[model samples]
Target: MRAIVVERTGGPEVLAPADRADPVPGPGEVVIDVAAAGVNFIDIYHRSGHYKMPLPFTPGIEAAGTVTAVGPDVTGLSAGDLVASSDVRGAYAERAVIDADRAVPVPAALSAEDAAAAMLQGMTAHYLTHSTYAVQPGDTVLVHAAAGGMGLLLTQYVKLLGGRVIGTVSTPDKERLAREAGADEIVGYAGCAAAVRELTGGEGVPVVYDGVGKATFEDSLAALRRRGTLALYGAASGPVPPFDPARLAPSGSLFLTRPTLVHHIATREELTTRATDVLTRIARGELRLHIGRRYRLADARTAHEDLAGRRTTGKLLLLP
Candidate 1:
């Protein structure tokens, strides 16, 4: 089997293609023939050592494919079953192993590429809107990087919950994409807080979903209504610099949280529910997945380069 191995942490050049032995399932695990693997920022974090992983490992967390082998103690799943999974590692290869319980059945209406695209980002968006803030009807919210992969999903889900979306993007093209995804208002990075305030009639939004981290953390606080919540989920630009808690007091007495998808889906049941909800929505067309780019497994380096350069939008996938 072919895989992209991160021999050391540094730049995109570290993701070297190599031939390796095919994976086999262990007890309670299944080996899947990888059809499509989702390329996420988390993978970059790992490859760059921002989020540490042991040296010389495969660097993917989400994928969808047909089951080729099932291990002992795994029930209700067998070879030839179509499945998708998030929270699994080693997906940047022709075949990957995941615990059977962690894999969810993919609906016939969705293709493997779309299924792979929907799992990680979709579930993250799900927990953010449903659990983190629980957006209310008619409530206004701010979403940063609104044309990016997670941003697009977050915008759509916020709209589905009947909340008004105020999105921020880097360019006019992205602004248009965010608006098409249901953003009630769009603004660039500069003066974003003022824009949000103006859009909300100067009261500010009740919640701010910020993924751009260092680039917009302070502005995110400034754009929130009194007692509003700020869910800081990603550090796409860079990690936010440390600051005094005293700042939050004047920033509308705001509530702040740093969330990761793993903590939200810590249990098997939670994982199943979130994955099922996101995938079912995609299957039924309630959610639209934008696959911004696709690359061959051997071209993983180029994929990382484009992602790091901010040259792509929406979900990126690697085909095995």
Candidate 2:
């Protein structure tokens, strides 16, 4: 099997392509021939050592493919099953193993690439809107990086829940993409807080979905209404520095939370529910997936560089 191996943690240059023996499933696990692996910010964090991992590991957690082997204690799945998982083990390879329970059945209406593209970011958007700070109808919410993969999903999900979205984008191209995804208003990073205030008639929004951490944390706080919530999910630019909790009091009793997808999908039932909703929506065209680019398995280094440099938009996938 061919895989991208990280023997050391540093820059994207450290992601080296190498040949490895095929993976075999362990108890309660299933092995799949990976068709596409989702390239995400989490993968970048793992490669850069921002998120610690054991040395000499493959650096992907989400992929979609056809099951070729099923291990002991696994049920309701068999060889030749089409599955995708957000919890794949060493997913940056031609073959990988994952727990059977973590695997989600991909709809026949969807392609393997789209399934891979949708899992992590799609479920994150689902939980952020439906669980973390449930958006009520008529509520106005702010979404940062509203042109990126997660941003587009958040914007569309908010609109589906009957809320208006005020999105922040860096470029005109991004602004157009955000608007196409149903963003009610698009503003540049500069003076975004003031723009949100003016757009909301000085009342601000009920919640701000911030994925671009550090760079946009203060603006996100400033754009919130009284008793609003700030769901800080990702740090695309960089991680935010530690701060005093008392800062929330002056921001009208604001709520700040840093949530992850693993907690929301801790149980197999919860994972299924969220994954099903996202995949079904995509299959029915209610949710649109933009696969910005695809690269060969050996080009994982380039993929990481492009993503970390913010040189691409939408979902990026590595095809093996």
Candidate 3:
């Protein structure tokens, strides 16, 4: 099997193409012939050592493909099953293994590319809106990086739940994309908090969905109504520095939370439920996934470069 191996953590240059023996299914696991792998910030974190991993490991965690073998103790799944998972091990390769319980059945209407693109970001958007800070009808919420993969999903999901979205974008193209995804109003990074205040008639929004971390942390707090929640999910520009909790008191007694997808899908039932909801919506044409670009498996370095530089919009996929 050909995979992107990281022998050391430093930069995207550390992601090297290498040949390895084919992965075999372990107990309670299934090996799939990977069709596509999702490129994400977490992969960048692993490559740059921001998130530690054992040396000489494959770099991806989400993919969709066809199951070719099942391990002992695994039932209800078999060869030829089309599955996708956000917890697959060594997903940046031609083949990967995942525990049966973590693999979600991809609906017949979705392609392998779409399934791979939707799992991690789709599920993340799901938990952020539905669990972290549930958006209520007539609620106006703020979404940062509203044209990126997670941003587009967050925008649409908020609209689906009957809320209006005020999105922040860096470029005209991104602003157009955000509006296409149902953003009610758009604002630039500069003076976004003031824009939010003026748009809401000085009331601000009920919640702010922030994935751009340090770059927008304080402003996200300022763009909220009194006692509103700030769901800080990702740090695309960089992680936010530690601050006093007392700061929240002056910021209208705001609530700040940093949530991850792992905690939301801690149980198999929760995992399947969330995955199914997102996939089914896609199948029914209610949710839309925007795949900005597809790179060959060996070009993983360029993919990371583009993503980390914020030069790409929508979901990125690696075709293996």
lDDT of 2 by residue, 210-255 (tens): 9899999999999999999999999998999998999999889999
The TM-scores, one per candidate, come to 0.98, 0.99, 0.99
Worst 10 residues of 2 by lDDT: 304-313
Q: Which stretches of candidate 2 lie over 4 Å from their true place?
A: none
Q: Which is superior by lDDT, 1 or 2?
A: 2
Query: RMSD of each candidate?
Result: 0.9, 0.7, 0.6
Q: Distance from true position, residue 186, model 3, in Å? A: 0.4
The whole-model C-alpha lDDT of candidate 2 against the native structure comes to 0.94
Q: Model 3, which residues run further than 4 Å from truth?
A: none
Worst 10 residues of 3 by lDDT: 242-251
Candidate 1 residue-wise lDDT, 1-320, digit = tens: 99999989999999999999998789999999999999999999999999889888999999999999999999989899989998666999999999988899998899999999999999999999999999999888899989999999999999999998888888888888888899988888988999888888899988889988998998998998999998999988899998787888987788999999999888989999998889888888889999999999999999999998888889999999
| Best of the two (1, 2) by TM-score | 2
